[model samples]
Target: MTSLTLALDAMGGDHGPLVTVPAALQALKSNPSLKIILIGNQADIDPLISHADSTVLNRIERIHTTEIVTMGDRPVHALRTRKNSSMRLALEQVRDGKAAACISAGNTGALMAMSKVLLKTLPGIDRPALVSCLPTVSGKPVYLLDLGANVACDSETLFQFAVMGSVLCEAINKNPTPKVALLNVGIEEIKGNDQVQQAGQILQHTEQLNYIGFVEGDEIYTGNVDVIVCDGFVGNITLKTSEGIAKLLVHQLKRGLNSGFFVRFLSKLISPRIQAVLSKMNPDHYNGASLIGLRGIVVKSHGNADEAAYLQAINLAATEAKRRLPEMINDRLESILLDINS
Candidate 1:
């Protein structure tokens, strides 16, 4: 099997090389066939590599650049001004076919903007969607799309998201005909606005789409649907709210367990089970969000992600690369368009 190569934006996130270098090392250790190209200032990256094992260090390569894209940098400004920055350079590797995928913990807006411009959108896709895996009650993940990529969308865009999301679920989850749904106020047909309702009509008529009508916010984690499509404004708010609740639940559990001797003893008795539950719900495990519908693969890690979270993001990119995700999306998209035209 050919080894997979991923480009990393070493100087893009909150901690920059401090978090990314360690994460890259961990990912390399986990997958012996994996090669990583770290793009950033060599002055900062070399010292971090010096501490790694020689065996691991041999598989790593570096592309140096002094410029960095700040977290506050505007997407347009970064595109025009910071072309040589780590994030842009890493993405360029993907466009040039030097890397199968690119992973970055940088400005979300800037990353999407640069990727769309460089990698370009796939045929039949109007815009790329920010997609991520969310844990469900059935021990499988449900794919959610448009997580703050485009704030507003038309009915056609929503239909395209459903197609892209369905392909993603099939690729990642190995489901042949994944169940797709539209996120709305309620499960009824008349719950959403004109755009959503119109999108629903299109999905219902599209051939081979396993669309199951509307899904409410409460049903997201029920494992009832394989893909959930929504506008970016709604999707972003939903994703952030879910993250907040997961953190709160974990914090409250820890606090309640440490209160008094009786509780502490009970916690020790059930700590393993509690830990298992918390681990499944941890946002760190689901840190990578794919910018779907682009010609090349790009996984976006949370800006504040630590070593473990960042490693998960790298793993996500590698998995997608090995699966040939772009090809799968293109095939499925062509089928969807053909159905529409027929």
Candidate 2:
């Protein structure tokens, strides 16, 4: 059995326990060996568990909390005022080693705030990272770091993100020595502004990673880069823009197909391919973001997430628990520092 039990925030997100509870049940079906400690009112959670299949619901246990962190509440206040809120209590479990990781879709700001205070960053890592996977052209995906949790990041933070992200690719995605790249406006080392240029130069010289040269913004989906590093400001903007573009393309494609009978015929001909493409585009497939470099695994889901989104987050938490993600990254970083000193 996996030694790590995942702490689930049963009262987070726009839908609260109603959305998260079903996702937890779905996760139990898919991942039998995984154990879950649900953080919410025992009455609320117990009813949902009873509603699930007898065999599967047996895997989950309620931790019993009564308060919740709403999406609009101040994160700091939620932690202090609602000490028993599902979000805060779940993380506290992870911090106390009662759980291996914590998963939430609650007040995003609160989750970020509470995680930093509870989990703390790993040694030598400047700041923790919020990483997500974006689709690449090669049918594979690229891991993008610092998507939105923190706005400002330095070279040292980016470096640690690289180390942690590389480990994520290896452990979660099962890629050994994943290829990493620093995101920049241009491919040339001399072309980007101060931060990009400096990170590129530093990454180019980094012996600890299989660091590739600069990756252009357009090349992110080429499947050419396994890991893309950048500051949170840039990364968040890029993530939103990419999502916007995806939506725009889908809308335009639909409009163009419905324009006329002839075009509609072509669309029907390509309908099978189109359906396949749309299926691949569902955001639920990559719904979880790792709050990497923290002491415990903390998976972040979309605030307005549906059951599928929470299901993805639960599966991600499951995977991280199985991998014991932090220990692996810490061991790798320690080895690198030791090698550098020697």
Candidate 3:
């Protein structure tokens, strides 16, 4: 693999340097070709990596910044006032081609706002969508998009999202013709809002995409579809709700197993298998959400992510950087738009 550098907002998340520093160290160890630029206060981050060997230390660089975009900070406020903040510096690395991608566990709104302003959206894409991978029942990864990036989307925006998601699925999942679906209230044609129906019609007519019909909320993890497109309002709720349900199921199973001595004895034998299944459904594995269709790759890690979870986010940025996902999406959209115009 070729060497690539990633810019990290080291002080962006809840745990700040404590989580990001350790995660960067782990990522560097796992991927020898990877270099990370930690953007944050030098004093806070130096202590964490000070003891590392020269080989590791050589690959890591730090950019000092004293400002932070807090979780409560508004997007406009951060953009206008926090130009020198770690988050902004991290994105600037990508904007200036100093880094292949930027990953942050910072304020979602601020990150999105700064990214769009600094990196800009790709041509043919009106807005960038927040897309993430989710483990499916078939053990494949399903891509879901618009996860709180744009709460309201028209049909044309939804079509662009499908195009971006489809390209992403093909690039990351290596599916030649990924099955794309629109998330709707029901499978029937008469069931959804006008935007969904119109978008479905547009997708169905597009020969370039393998656009399937509507899918309900329950089908997200069915693995029948490779990309599921929805507005941010619904997508965010579905993602959070699915994560909550997975955690609840694991908790309930453990509680039930411990309720009786006989069950507990059987749990000793069955616990490993159950845990293996639960681990696949763990949200940490899916912590990074890509803000797709931007000129530069930007991944938003869960604000509360721990070291391991944040590492997953870094890994995600690495993969997308290697794949040149934004270029692929732009090419695909251009081809599709040209075909439609013709």
Top candidate, metric TM-score: 3
* Best-to-worst lDDT order: 3, 1, 2
Q: What are the clashing pairs of model 2? A: 137-221
The lDDT values for all models are: 0.93, 0.84, 0.94
TM-score of every model?
A: 0.94, 0.93, 0.96
- Lowest lDDT sum, 10 consecutive residues, model 1, at 277-286
Candidate 1: C-alpha lDDT: 0.93
- Which portions of model 3 show Cα errors greater than 4 Å? none
User: How do the residues 1-342 of candidate 3 rate in per-residue lDDT, one tens digit apiece?
Assistant: 679999999998889999999999999998899999999999999999999888888999899999989889899999999999999999999999999999999999999999999999999899999999988888888999989999999999999999999999998878999999999999999989999999999998999999989999989988889999999999999988988887888888888899889999999898889888787677876899999989999999988898999999999899999999999999999999999889
Query: Candidate 3 — what's its lDDT?
Result: 0.94
Model 1, stretches more than 4 Å misplaced? 51-55, 251-261, 268-276
Candidates sorted on TM-score, descending: 3, 1, 2
